[model samples]
Target: MSSTAHEAPPWLRPRAAYVHIPFCAHKCGYCDFASLAGADHLADRYLDALERETAAKLGEPHEVDTIFIGGGTPTRLEAPALERLARMVAHWLPLAEGGEWTVEANPGTLDAAKADVLAAAGVNRVSLGAQSFQPRLLAALERNHAPEEVGRAVAIVRDRFPRWSLDLIFGVPGSNIDDWKADLDATLALDPSHLSCYGLVYEKGTALWKQLQRGEVEPVVEDVEREMYELVMDRLEQAGLHLYEISNYARPGHESRHNLVYWANDAYWGLGLGAAEYVEGTRTVNTRDMQAYLKRIEAGESATGPNERLGPEERARETAMLMLRRTILGIDRADFRLRTGYDLDTLLGPVIVRFVGEGLLEDDGRRVRLTHEGRFLADRVLCEVV
Candidate 1:
């Protein structure tokens, strides 16, 4: 499963690409992405390295179905720099006709000019980082935007782009039911095609984690968080948004096609610092160090990190776990058999029966899916299945 000198492209052509832009105006208190603040000076070098990595991984003129430019905060780039990066993608790995091109933007950074540039450059989708609408909650999270800025950003995006989404965070320590409901109401008022809601997590080495150690903030109780989650689901569904993934809801046709590639366990190429890719049965990631990534590109070197090659059995297990995340794409018994050369019924017979009996799973002859309660504990269920 090693990459040969010839760069062994797998039998299946990659339908997706994820480009990382690791620059932010300021990092959030709970952030751990490979992003930095006060690093705009490295923009030129990083773009050069990104283009090189793009060329090396995808080669020239390949047509991919979807392209996602995620961040630190992609909107932090100036209009000209953003245009350059977009044009490079168009020139190198041209997207398919009607392909989805999504860029992650922060509300504070996404100006109308930059939004227009992205639209003109064939970016059809924009995902805004409007984590919260409450100013006090945002201050606690160390986010910079005011509540008004989110509406303005959404207006600009809706006016300029063909499709757009908003990313929201809930379950913050100081946030109450009223605050959470208010955020949801504000978000729905904007009428975004897609919405992603995430529960706040305290990762080690993050500022939020440090605050917890210093007794500055407390973790939200699990029961309260679960209640908030239920409220979110009920509200969003009432507004006609379908819950596509655990944390994602979208209008019927507005689901993120690029993200679905990952959830479906398909191959993709990831370019830029700290980007990860899964191809040819191996998962590969680029170096997280920005300077090292740039230097290697300058020296015409590949900036790949450690690689993991999965055997057939391992790949099947991985695929099952990922596919189960999508509510619509239930696990097909026969397709699973063909892909893994293992019978799902035989391999997970006891586990499936137990879950089904407990009302955690539903088996409909040819496939299986998570029940409502099962969706909440999907992580634990996935662990059991895998």
Candidate 2:
């Protein structure tokens, strides 16, 4: 796409873009994302509204190095709709050469035709939601796919996309250490370039959360969960995947460039229903209601819900907190100073010293990073930083 000649609005142009597709075949019991099952009937209207929303929010066509299409399940869209969405992006946004374009897929939804369409539309990366490989755990999670479907989907994806990522969840109600290892082994057998392993957390309003409260399901023991975490790190590292973030591991050069924009606190434009954007120094979120989003777009009104402008010190604190989530940690002192216009030590000296003393942080000669223990309690550490 041709770049727009006009200067980008301070809150519009971003280095990365995240587009949310809020439809799924069925919502998992634990999911809280703004998504619904059987919403494909509104797919056409959603696409139209999405384009309008994009036009309103992204006033100038800037070259973006990373584009991440995530959501309930982007692959749930019909092939033609998927192609249309991809083309809409290419037509409206300038993409850098060899840019990272990724789409999130569910094993139950992806097929050969869909994979081909995505590849043809310049989608070079696929992140499959293969939460667990065990049939029992799959049932527990209410995932639609059979255990074998993950392998088949991976094979199809790897045949089409150069880079593929698999998302796995550990710490299920009945998940034992052996089962976790088996899941990891099954995933690695497919030879994916990236893996995102996450510990299960029960949100307050989810069905799983209710079940947890009612004693219908048991949470994994804290020490056992910690052991599972270590297992992932050890096994994935042996498989040659480096731990990039607390929950992400990647082979060299296969890291998710789009998500790094978030972890680095860099500017990004998020479009579509329930999407959030951080551009320049302001953050905005679109309405979660599909009807409201469409109505606003049809009326030629901004679909944004609320906007917040971040001041200099606030931005610096956010940057530090976000960067700390990465294994590489915050950049060297000079880079941090340049980005925030303040000395890193001056702003966070006491917190850093305290965490370092507690063995939760490490200050290498060039950069600071979270220790393994620190990653497990990342929320606490990040709260202290921000």
Candidate 3:
């Protein structure tokens, strides 16, 4: 694709990379990501194939500004395997100076030895999956780790990684406002550099969804869920953490840069099982099936499955959906045009006008952003605009 005159500093290279590790001790009932449980027996084989795939797909060292290794739980691997995985990534995806390297960890899987390996391999950030501090909530979420393990994991991360993030989930089947507030307060006590609070979504095919279907469980009422979200916003802001994106709060200069790459619709490299990559106007996803991915790599065949070349107009609409997630900054009119070659108003003028009149968005003649009321209805607004 040719760059438009408005595309200042056009993307010529990818600065971010994502590597997926699918092995986990247990798969949570709500997870739909590409992750395998009781797959430890295949760990060595998986790593071997991962190494070959990395070398084949990204020949030579590619310098990246950020590399995020997400799970089934990257820390699920034993010490030796964990070290090898870390080193393989470092060799193929070398980090630029002051680059951010993050690894996702489960509280039950992370230990002192694995933490040491990550720190030694230059990992600077750890995202701990601490769903909730309440035992009842934890059981409801089907998370394996005890609430106390979360504090232990945080201690390990704090002693090694310079920056760390904590994750919390709300609106579980039986949770109430008091339970939600306690979770928030416990999270605040940890004093993390970053925090992500998400309302639970029941995806089809998951155990949780099945439970809901069988009448074994009922989701939190919509009214209570809305209240939980409002509480998170107020509490995090009061803690001096600014809302950089919906569901994400960070201290100044601590925003997730890799995620920002996605929100800005910039190019990035993705590797491993079910990973998706977008570069040079094309999007491709690796095979989601573990055995199939391994077979393709061993046979020296392309592991990529579904792929698409996004057209200019389609890319522009998608960009609007993503950039709107940054509630504070929203969409800058000039920058949107520079990045997508489509004037914000010319492309979606009528839709924006409707939303602004509805008090779901703020159009200040310079930028288009979500209103406080709109944040609660973000999904509806984004759906209409896109």
Candidate 4:
């Protein structure tokens, strides 16, 4: 899609790109991302640095097939700054016709002005981080948004964007089955086109992890969490949202294209602090240090923090891990061989046969997917094979 003669060959062009917005009103207990609260004063400088980073990509206008602007609360940017950021990105990373352009927003942060700016700038989708509709659970998760704010954000989004998603967290400490079902009830009331329900995870170094260490909270039983997940699948399907991936459900044709890029093991560009990019068979992660990222941009140096190029054997294993996450459409054997250059039978056939016999994996000669029993034990099964 490049217009210049010096551009990389078509094969090297990225089909997807991601932009990071790293400011928030306050940090959530479970967040470990490069976000700074009480740093609204740095917004102007951060935007300037982000533009510089985008410019360094220097190329004739080219179209990316998908663009996802994620955050530390992308909606935290003021209306004008948000508008400018949207325009700057559109100018530098033009979208292909029908490309999926999405921005992630927190419940209370999104306003009508921000929604208008996003819609006018061609952001056709919004993913609202509405952790829970239950006030007690929201507090437990340290999410700073009223339950009412979600419906308000949903109103703003639905009027402008036809495709929007809600993020809900289940398995919060002390939450019972009724509470989990209530969260689902509230979400379905909005009639969202897409939905993601994730179980609470206490990532190391996060406040939640420290709380666990201090015995301030107890972990939910694994059996209960699994039951919550099964409920999510059943209720969402009954509500007409199909389970396309383990954590994601969507109405027809409304699946997240950008996230699908990662699950499909395809290439994408990541711009901004703490972002990651996978392109041309190499994976690169930018520094999570905001100052380091800004300084590299100011000096016109590569902000590419660290990267790895996987060997053929490693790539095959990685592909298996990612593809199995897709509950419905699992690995395509022909595509696997074509993409990884590893024969399915020669490399993983034995494990596939064993799992199939164990009722963990189902292989239909062309595609291999997890059986219902296998989905619950996905992590263990994938580890054994990978």
Go through the candidates in order and give each one's C-alpha lDDT: 0.86, 0.88, 0.90, 0.87
Q: What stretches of model 3 exceed 4 Å from their correct place? A: 1-12
| Residue pairs that clash (backbone atoms under 3 angstroms), model 3 | none
Per-prediction TM-score to the true structure, in the order listed: 0.95, 0.96, 0.96, 0.96
- Which of the two, 1 or 3, has more lDDT? 3
Pairs with steric clashes in candidate 4: none
The RMSD of every model to the true structure, in order and in angstroms, is 3.2, 1.9, 3.1, 1.9
Better of 1 and 2 by TM-score: 2
Point out where model 2 deviates above 4 Å.
4-13
lDDT of 2 by residue, 219-274 (tens): 99999999999999999999999999999999998889998888877789889988
Model 3's alpha-carbon lDDT is 0.90
Candidate 4 lDDT, 110-186, residue by residue in tens: 99999999999999999999989999988998899999999999999999997999998888887988999899999
* Quality of model 2 by C-alpha lDDT: 0.88
**TM-score of candidate 4 to 2 decimals:** 0.96
Q: Give residue 252's error in model 4 in angstroms.
A: 1.7
Clashes of 4: 0
State the displacement of the C-alpha of residue 268, model 3, in Å, after optimal TM-score superposition.
1.0
